[model samples]
Target: MKRVIYGLFNRLRFKHKLFLSYLLVIFIPIMVLGVYSYKQSEQMLNMQAIQGIEKNVDTISESIDGSVERYNHTIQSIVYNKTFQKIVTNDYLDLVNLSYDLKEYLTPYLNMMVMLDKEIDQVTFYTQTYVPEYGDSVLSAARVENEQWYKDAMNKTGSQWFFEDGLFVVSKFPRFFADKATNLVYMRVNDDSLFKNVTDLAKDYSVAIADEQGRVIYSNQSASKNTLDADALIRMNEGALMVGGAESFLVKKAVRQTGWTIYCIVPAVQVSPNVGSIINATLIIIGACMLGVLIIIWIFSKTMIRRIYSLNVWMKRVEIGDLRMRIRSDSKDEIGELTNRFGTMLIRLNELIDELYRNKIVQKEAEFKALQWQMNPHFLYNTLSFINWKALKSEAYDISHIVTTLSKFYRTGLNRGDNIIPVRDELEHIKSYIEIIQIMKDYSFDVTYEIDEAVFDYTTINFILQPLAENAIKHGINRKTTGRGMLRIKAKLGDRTVEFTVEDNGEGMPPETAKTIMQNQCSGYGLKNVNERLQLRFGSDYSIAVESIAGSCTLMKIIIPQNIQS
Candidate 1:
C-alpha cells in the first residue's frame, strides 16, 4: 500500500507546477517591469514640468537682458550728448561745470545713475580723472584690489556710467561693471540701484540680478537675499552654463538667448494615482487568469488522481506475483495508454514464466534418468564382483546378501523404466551402492543420514543420491590422502523439499573443476547426467553443487523439491 502511494506522487504532472509557480513568477516580473516603465514615465513627466519652469526662467532672464540692452542704448545717448564736448577734449577740466549738463543727459536712464553717484554699500565704479570731485577716495577694497577700471578709466576724457567689482555677478582683480561708465565731468557711480527689471515675467518664480562683482544688485525678495547659488555664478563665469536642483537655479542661457535648469517638483502622491491605477489593473488581470487556471488544474488533478489510483490497484497484484492479472482500460488518454501497455507486458511475462515451468520438468527428468543409470551400471559391476568374491571366499556361501542388495539397487535405479520414484525408494538405492563401494574399497565413506520422515512419503525422481555418492567415491576419496573421509545425505520437509550432501576427505578437485564437472555437458556421464536430469524435473533453480579445495575434501549438495518432481 505504501509503495503504490509513492508511485503516484512520483508521476505528478510538470505543467501543474509551472502553472502555480507563474503566480509568483508573473508578479515578480510585473513589479520589475512596472518599476522600470514607471521610472520612464516619471522621467518624462519631470522633464515636462522642468521644461515649463525653464520657459518661465528664460522669459525673466530675457527681461533682465532687455534692461541691460536698454541701459546700453541709454548710455549711448549720454555719450553722444552735446553737453559732454568739453569732457571729450583738452578743455576736459571744464567738466566740473558739465556735471549739471551731464545730469540732464543721464535723465532717461538716470534713476539708477544718480543713485550710483552716491556712495552705497558694497558697490564700486569708475569715471574720468577730470571729474575728480568725488575725490581719489578710491581705496583698494578688502575684497577687490588693483582694479583696471579705476586705473585705466581715470585716464579717459569720456563721460559714461557703469558698475565695477565689489560684490556683484562677476569678479576679478580688475573690477569691470556690466553697464555704463563715468567720464571726466563725473564722480563715481557705485550703487546697488544700477540694474532693474524691465518686464513682469516670472511672477511664479523668484528672481534676482547681480552686477559684475556677483553681488545681487536687485531682487524680488528682501535685501541681502539671493535666489541663485553664489557658487552657480562662479560656475557660470567659468563657462559651465546654467545649474539647478531642488533648491536653486541660475538662468544662464536659452531660447537661442536665455536658458536655465529648474526643478518644478510636485508631491509624489499626486502622480502616483494615475500610474498606480495602471499597475493595479495589470496585477488584477494576472491574478484573475491565475485563479482561472488554478480552478482548471484542481478539477483536472482530481480526475487524474482517480485514473492513477485505478492503475495503482491493478499493479498491486502484479508486484505480488499474480502475473496473469491485467488492468482493463478503454480510455485513450495517457493513463489508459499506460494501462494497455502494462497488460500486454503482463501477458508476455506470464507466458515466459509458464514456459520456464514446463522446461523445468523436462530438464529434471533427463537429469534423474542419467543419475539413475549412473548408479545401475556401477552397482551391477560392483555386485558382480561382490558375488565373485564370495564364490572365491567359499563355494557354498549363500547368495542372498548379494542378490538382495542387487535387487534393491536395481529396483530403485530402474522404476519400471520410468524416471520418477518415491523418496524412500531412491534413498534405498543409494545405500546399496554405498555398501558395495565400501566392500570393494575397504574404506568407510562415513555416512550420516537425516530426514523429515514425512518427506519419505513424497515422490522424487529416482536415483537422486547415487550419482552424488559416486562423485564422492571417485573425486572425494583422493582429496584427503591421509584420512578415511565422510559422506552425508539428508532430506527435510520445507516449503519445498530440502535435500543435502554426501561429502568425503579425498583428493578434492579444484572449485572450478568441481563446478564444471557438475554443470557442463563436457564432463560425460555421472555428474553431468545427474545435473541435467534434476533441472529437467525441478527447475534451473534446483540442482547439485560441489564445494571443494585441492588438498582438503569435497561436499556434494543436492537440492530436490518433493512437490516439483515429474
Candidate 2:
C-alpha cells in the first residue's frame, strides 16, 4: 500500500504536489495547535528582548573602553618621545636653533601622531616659559592658567579625562621631567567618535554615559521628554524603572578604562505586544489558513521555477564557448548544489589554461639555456685576465684596469647559472658597471653608496641592480647640462623586508611618463623585466616603485621579503 501511494503522488503535477504537501503538513497542524503556541511565544519574546538589550549595552561599553585605551596609548607615546622631551625641556639662548628644532622635529612628530590615530582631533602643548608660538600646536600657559580644567591637570600626577564644549579632552604631566611638571599635554578626542555607538541605538531606546561622580557626559535623548537620569540608573543597576509614570527596562555597564558608566533604557510595552490582541488575531489567522496555504504554494512553485530557469540559461551560455559565465543561489536544495558544481567546473578549466601558459614559459627558458651553453664563459674570462696582465706589463694602466673590471662584471653576472645570489655580489656587480661608466663619460657624474652593513646578509635575484644602475646613467645623469650629476644607491633593513633605492639628481620626466614607464616598452626593457621577475619570484605584492619630479630627481625603489629563500 505504501508503494502504491508513493506512485500515485509521483504522478501528480508539480503545483498539485506542493498544494497537497502544504495542506496535509502545515495547515491542519497549525489550525489545531497555533493558539497555545502563540500564547507561549509572547513570554519567550519578552525574555529575549531583555537579554538582547543587556547584550547591546555591554557591547557599547566595550567599544567605548577600546576607544579610550587607544587614546591613552597615543598620549603616552607623545609624552615619551625623545624629540618632544627635548623641545619642551631645552633652555634656549638663541632663537635660531629653537626655530630650526621646531621646524625639523616637533612639527613632523606631531603631524605623524595625528595621522596615525584618526580619533585625535588636535594635540596642543602648553609651556610656562616664554617661547614664540608656531601654530595651534604650541601656546603660552597664560592662555589656560585660569581655567579649571587646566589647573586640575597641573596638580594631577596622572592622566585625567574631561568633557568641554562637546569634546573629550585628555590631560597629563610628563612624569619623567620633574622641573617641567607645570607643562601640560592636551589631546582632544573627536566628539562624534566617542558617542558613535550610543547614537546607533534604536529611537525608542535611550543611552547615557556618565562620570564616576554621576555627571552626565553624553545623552542620546537629551532633547526628548523621555531622557533617563544618570544617577537614578546607576543606583538601580539592572531592573525596571518608572519614568513619567510608565515602567521601562534599564541596564547599565561600566567602562573599564575610564571610570564611567553606560545606561540604557527602553519602554516595557515595546518588548511584547498585548497578549489578548495576539490571541484574537490568531483566531482570524486560522480561518484564513487554507487560502494562505494555497498562496504560499503558488509563490514557492514560481520561485523554484525561476531559479531552475536561471540555471538552464547559464548552462546554455557555457555550451556556446562562454566558460566565464556563472550563477549563484543561496538555496540548500538540489538545484543549488548543481549550480555550485558548475561553478567548480569553470574554475578547473581556467586553472588548466594557466598551467599550459606556464609550461610554454618553461620551454622557452630551456631553449635559452641551450644557447648559453654554446659560448664558453670560462675561456672568455681567462682571455680577459691574460690581456689585463699584458697591458699592466706594458705600463698601460687604464686599459689594464678596464679589462680587470670587465672580467669582474661578467663573473658576477653569470654567477654559475644561479638565479639567486648574496646581496653583496649584486652590489659588487653594480660597482663594476659604475666604474666602466665613469671611465667612458670622463668622470662627469659622482656616485655614492650609503648601504647599511646589515643588508649584506640577505639574498636577492642576480643581475637586478646592474640594469637599474645602467638606466640611471643612460637616462638620468647623461641628460644633465649643468653641474655634475649625482647618483646615490642605498640599501637598508626594513620591517620583515629589505629596501633598495637608486636615486639620481638630473633631468627627470613628467608624472604621467613616470607612471607608465614600467609598462611602456619604449621607456626601457630593463625596468619592465625587473618588475616582472620580482613579481613572478615573490608575488604580486613585491614590485618596483618609481618616483620622479621634472627637472629635479628620479628614484626607483625595490622592496622584497628579507626571509626569502633561493
**Top candidate when judged by TM-score against the true structure:** 2
Any runs in candidate 1 off by more than 4 Å, and if so which? Answer: 1-328, 332-349, 352-360, 363-400, 442-455, 492-496, 509-517, 522-525, 532-536, 539-541, 561-566
Candidate 1: C-alpha lDDT: 0.55
- Per candidate, the number of residue pairs that clash is 43, 0
Candidate 1 per-residue lDDT over residues 400-453, each given as its tens digit? 455556666776677766766677787788888887676566645576677667
Cα displacement (angstroms), candidate 1, residue 336, comes to 5.1
Clash pairs for candidate 2:
none
